[model samples]
Structure formats: C-alpha cells, structure tokens
Target: MGVGEQLVTYVTQNGYYIWEEFYRHFLMAAYGVLFASIVAIPIGILISRYGRLSKWVLSFGSIIQTIPALGFMALLMVTLGLGTTTVITTLFFYSLLPIIQNTYVGMKSVDQTVIEAAHASGMTRFQLLRKVELPLAVSVIMAGIRTALVVGIGIVAIGTFVGAGGLGAIIVRGTNATDGTAIILAGAVPTALMAIIADLIMGMIERRLNPANKASAASQ
Candidate 1:
C-alpha cells in the first residue's frame, strides 16, 4: 500500500489506542499548567505587592526558563525517575515564567486612581485585590495561562522519553520501523491537531475575558 493508505489503515485499526494517548497527552499538559498556576499566581501577587522582590523572583523564573527542555527533563529524572511525575514536574517549571510574569504585569496594570478610590471607600488591601484588581487583571492572567498550556502540549510530547506515554510514543515507534513515515504521521498529525485545537480554545477564552472585548460587545 502507499504511504497514505498505510496511514489510513493504521489509524483505522488503532483509533482507540490513539484516542487514549491523546487524552493522556492533554491531561499531562493541563495538570502541569494547572499546578504552576496555583503556585505562580500567588507568588505573582506577592511580588506585585513587594516591588523589590519582583526582580529577584522573576529573574529566578527566567533562569529556569532558560534551561533546555530535554536537559531540564533529564535533570529532573535524576530525582523524579521516569513516568508522568517527571514529565509533569518539568512542564510545571516550564510554565512558571509566563504565568508569574503576566500576573505581575496584570496587577501592575490596574489603574492607580481606581485603587485610590477603592481605598477611600474603606476597602482593605486584600479586599481591593480580590474585588477590583483581580477582576481587571484576570484576562491578562488567562493569556499567560493560555500560553503556558499551548507550550506545555509540545513539551509533554517529549515525555515519552521518560516512559510517560503520549502520542510521542507512537512517533518513537515509527522511528524504529523500517518505513515508518506513515506511522510517524499518524502520531504527529494528532499532536499538531491537539495543539491547534487547544490554542483556538484558549484564544477564545482570552478574547472573551478581555475588558475591551466586553465593552465592544456591550456597545454593539
């Protein structure tokens, strides 16, 4: 059979397996971003409160971001060993910079006049952050999260190296085969599709959350 036929046949036969791997791949990416958000968001907020700390904290995250993906994963493997844990841990580190940076920027972006007004109304610092700053900054924060997630999906594909099964495993299998272009495509195609779909979904959410977009919609 031709390469196209071979690809079709493979996909047709292994649809269930591919679906399972796709689901697994997505979850691994999602978990990494989610965990990063929980920690990074708080740190972002704290750093925003203490301006002096922002430089050191963000620089540290930037240093982590500079590490090569595979090298970072390999370093983690020394302690984490193999499996989803190592992959997820690597992804979590990878996700930190964008999230924390965006959160800081978002918090900083809030209008000082608004803050002063809130304070005049007797709102506590905590109350101001919770009620005013956060709502205003949520879209920017989501943009960071969206970036992290899209990037994580690509990184998670590398997790197969550490025995964290995902579509990358299939691609690896293709590499082993004598004429595995079809098999490679079977894996690569799905991964690309997953990334595209994820980006689109996250982009929609970002746009919806944007204050300008809301105002435009209301005006319309």
Candidate 2:
C-alpha cells in the first residue's frame, strides 16, 4: 500500500488505541516538566539569593544540557533499568536548565530600588521574595517552562525505546516494519500538534502574567 493509504488504514482501524498512545506520550512529558519545575525553581530561587553561587549552579546545568539526550538515557538505563521511571527522570533533567536559568534571571531583573523599598517597608527576606521578586519574575519563569514543555514533548518521543510506551512506539514500529512513512506520521503528527498546543496555552499564560502586558492591555 502507498504510505498515505497505510496511514489512513492505520488511523481508521486503530483510532482508539492511537489516542491512548497520544495520552501516554503527553503524560510522559507533562509529568517530567511539572516535577522539573518544582525541583528547579527552588534551586533558582536559592542561587538568586546567593548570587555568588549562581554561576557555578548554572554552569552545572549547562553541562548537563550539553550531553546528548539518547546517550544520557542509555546511561540511566544501566542503573535504573527500563520503563517510565527512567524516561521521566531523564526528561526531568532535560527540563531543568531552562527553568532554573529563567527563574534566576527573572528574579534578578527585579529593580534594586524596588527591592530596597520592600526591605524598608519591613518585609522579611522570604516575604520580599514571595511578594516582590517572584511575582515580577513570573513571566521569565513561565517562558522557561514553555520552552521546556515543547522540548520535553519532543524528547519524550524517545522514551518508547526504553519500553516507556508513547507515540514514539508507533514510529519505532513503523521503522522496523519497512520504514512505513504513513505509520510514522500517525505518531509524528499528533506529537507535533501537542507541542504546538502546549506552546500556545503556555504562551497565553505567560502574557497574562507579564505585568507589562497587563498594563498595556489596561491602557488600551
């Protein structure tokens, strides 16, 4: 059959199963990004407070980012074995740099005068961070998250190699089965859509959180 015909047949016959794979693929990325944010954001906050340490912390993350994704996942497989745990952990590491760097940059960008004002107003260090620094820096932080989310979705497709079932499984199957272009597209198309939709949603959220965007809207 032609590739196009094969794709039509695959989708028509296995629509429900395909949807399940799509959901699994999404969950794999979503879980990684969510947890990465939780872990990295705090580290970013800590480094921001101790500016001397920020360079070293970010350098480590940058080093991790430089490692090839598949190679790192294979390394994890040696100790962790296979399946979703290994995949999630690998993807989690991939998601960290953008969030950590962005969070640090965002909070640091808050005006020193504003910070001093808050200090003079009797805010504790934690209070100043919670109320003043993080709020202003939220846009940059969200931008990092959005970047990670899109990147995570693409990377999670590789999870299938380790028995972490996702849409990538279909692509792998297609590659094994005569390099069927149609079979691969069934998985690839949806994965691309997930990236697009995630970016759009996260972008809207970022713009909403940005103070400048809010003020511009109010002015109009």
Candidate 3:
C-alpha cells in the first residue's frame, strides 16, 4: 500500500491507542511544566527582589538547559527508574530556564513609577507584589509558561525511551519495522498537531493576560 493509504489504515486501526498515548503525552508534559512553575516562579520572584542573585540563579538554569535531554533522563533514571517519572523529572529541569528567566524579566519590567505609586499608597512589600507587580508581570510569565509547554511536548516524545510510552513508542515501532513510513507519520502527525494546538491555546491565554490587550479591549 502507498504511504498515504497505509497511514490512514494505521490511524484508523489504532485510533484508541493513539488517543491514549496522546493523552498520556500531554499529561506528562503538562505535569512537568506545572511542577517547574511551582518552584521556578517563586524563585524567579525572589531573584527579582534580590537582583544580585538573579545572575547566579539564571546561570544555574542555563547550565541545566545545556544538558542533553536523553543524558539528563539517563542520570535521573538511576534514582527515578525507567518510567514516566524519569521523563517528567527530566522535563521539569528542562523547563526551568525559560520560566525563571521570563519571570525575572517580567517582574523587573514592571514600571518603577507604578511600584512607587503603590508604595506611596502605603502598600506593604507583599501587598505591592500581589496587587501590582504580579498583575503587570502575569502576561510575560504566561509567555514563559507557553514556551515551556510547547517545548515540553516535543521533549516528551523522547519519553518512550524510558518506558514512559506516548506517541514516541509508535515512532519507535515504525523505526523497528521495514518500510514503516506510514507508522512513523501516524505518530509524528499527532505529535506535531499537539504542539500546534498547545501553542495556539497558550498564545490566546497570554494575549488575554496582557495588560495592554486588556486596556485596548476595554476601550473598544
């Protein structure tokens, strides 16, 4: 059969399997980003407060980013074992750089005038951050999260190597078979689609969170 026809056949026959793997893939990626955000955002905020530490913290995150995904997972596997845990943990480390960097930049980007105004109003440090800085920085923070998630989707494809399953397994199966172009495309097509959908969704959320966009919409 032709590659196109075979692709259709494979997808049709494996609809449930594809759907299950797709769900698993998204969950792993999403969980990794979520976990990273919980830690990274707070650290980012702290570093923004203490400017001296920003360089060191970002440097460490960059170092982590320099590590190859497969190698990183291999190291984690020694403790986490061969499974989704290893994949998720690897993804978490991979996700840290963009998020922390963005958060720091976002917080620092907030207008000093606005911060001064908040302080003049007798707002405490915590209140100023919660009420003023966070709102202004939220869109930029969201942009970082969006980047992390889209990248994580791609990284999760490698999870199959660790026995984490996902569409990568299908791709691997295709590689093992003779003339498995159709099976490979069957896996690849969905992976690409997932990344595209995630980008679009996150882009929308980022736009919505943007203060300038909100102001423009309100004026309209």
Candidate 4:
C-alpha cells in the first residue's frame, strides 16, 4: 500500500491498539506517580517538620534522579525478568526522585508564619499538615507529578524492550521493519499527546486545589 493508504489503514485498524497502548502506559505511569507521592510526601513532611533531615533527603533523591532510566530498566530486567511487573517497578523507582524532591521543597517552602499560626490555633501536627501545609504545598507537589507523568510517558516506551507491550510495540515493530519514519511517528506522536494531556489535567487539578486560587476566586 502507498504510505498515505498505509497510514490510514494503520490508524483505522489499530486505533484501539493505540488507545490500549496509551492506557496501559498511562495507568502504569499513574501507579508510579502514586507510589512516588506516597513515599515522598510523608518523608517530605517529616523533613519539613524536622528541618535537619531536609538536606539529606533532598540530596539522596537528587542522586537517584541522576541514574539514567535505561540503566535502571536494564538492571531491573536482569533481576526481575521482562514483564509488566518489571516495567512498573522500574517506572516507580524512576519516579521517586522528582516526587520526593518536590514534596520536600514544597513543604519546606510553606510559610513559617502560616505554620506558626496553625500551631497557635491549636492545630495538631496532623491538622497543621492537612489544613495549612498540604494545601499550600499542593502546587509544588503537582509540579513534581507533572514532571513524573511526562517522564514516565516517554520512558514507558522502553518497556517494549522488556516485553511490556504499549505504543512502544509499534516503534519496535517499525524498527525491526527498518521503517524509520514509522518508528518515529508511531512512538513520538501518541506519547507527546499523552504527556501534554496529562500535564494539562494535572495543572487543572493543581489550580483547583490551590487555596490561594480559591480565595482569590471567592473574592472576585
């Protein structure tokens, strides 16, 4: 078939395949983000509360961030074998640095006076975190999530190498077929779209969650 005809056929035949690919990776990415957030947020809060550990945790997470994605994936594949479990695990680890760093930074960046006021108001530690600190830190935390989502979407293509099917499968097929253009467009297009959509959605969540935004809107 001609290239145009081929493109049309591929899209029509594999639209669901593309969506499935996107969804699988997207879900995996979400899991990774959630895992990272769960691990990071509490640690971040602890560091913020203690002040002394902030530097150490931030430094440690930064070190993790320096480990390349492919390197980590390779190591996991060697130890865990190729599959969804391995891919998800790899993505989760890759996600940690940003989430932890951002959560720590976000919580630390919360205004001292706000925290002091919360304490003066008889807010317990949990109450202060839930009411004052977390709400204030949401934006920065969201920023980290955004970064992880985008990075995860792209990195998920690597899962193809480890037998975790996704859009990466298309790229892999195109590669084996020696179709450079197919590989490029097939992999690049959907991943970019997914990342863009994910970021926009997270941004909306961040805006909605931001107390300052809500207060301003209330005033307006």
lDDT of each: 0.94, 0.92, 0.95, 0.80
lDDT of 2 by residue, 74-120 (tens): 99999999898888899899999999999999988999999999999
Off by over 4 Å in 1: none
User: Where's the lowest-lDDT run of ten residues in candidate 4?
Assistant: 178-187
Candidate RMSDs in Å, in order, are: 1.1, 1.4, 0.7, 1.8
Model 1: lDDT of residue 179? 96
Please report the TM-score between candidate 2 and the true structure.
Answer: 0.95
On TM-score, the leading prediction is 3
Better of 2 and 3 by lDDT: 3
Ranking by lDDT: 3, 1, 2, 4
- Ordering by TM-score: 3, 1, 2, 4
Question: Least accurate stretch of 10 residues (summed lDDT) in model 3?
Answer: 65-74
Per-residue alpha-carbon lDDT of candidate 4 for residues 105-132, written as tens digits (9 for 90 to 100): 8888898998898899899988988888
The list of candidate 2 runs beyond 4 A from truth reads 218-220
Off by over 4 Å in 3: none
Error of 4 at 7 (Å): 1.7
Per-prediction TM-score, please? 0.96, 0.95, 0.99, 0.91
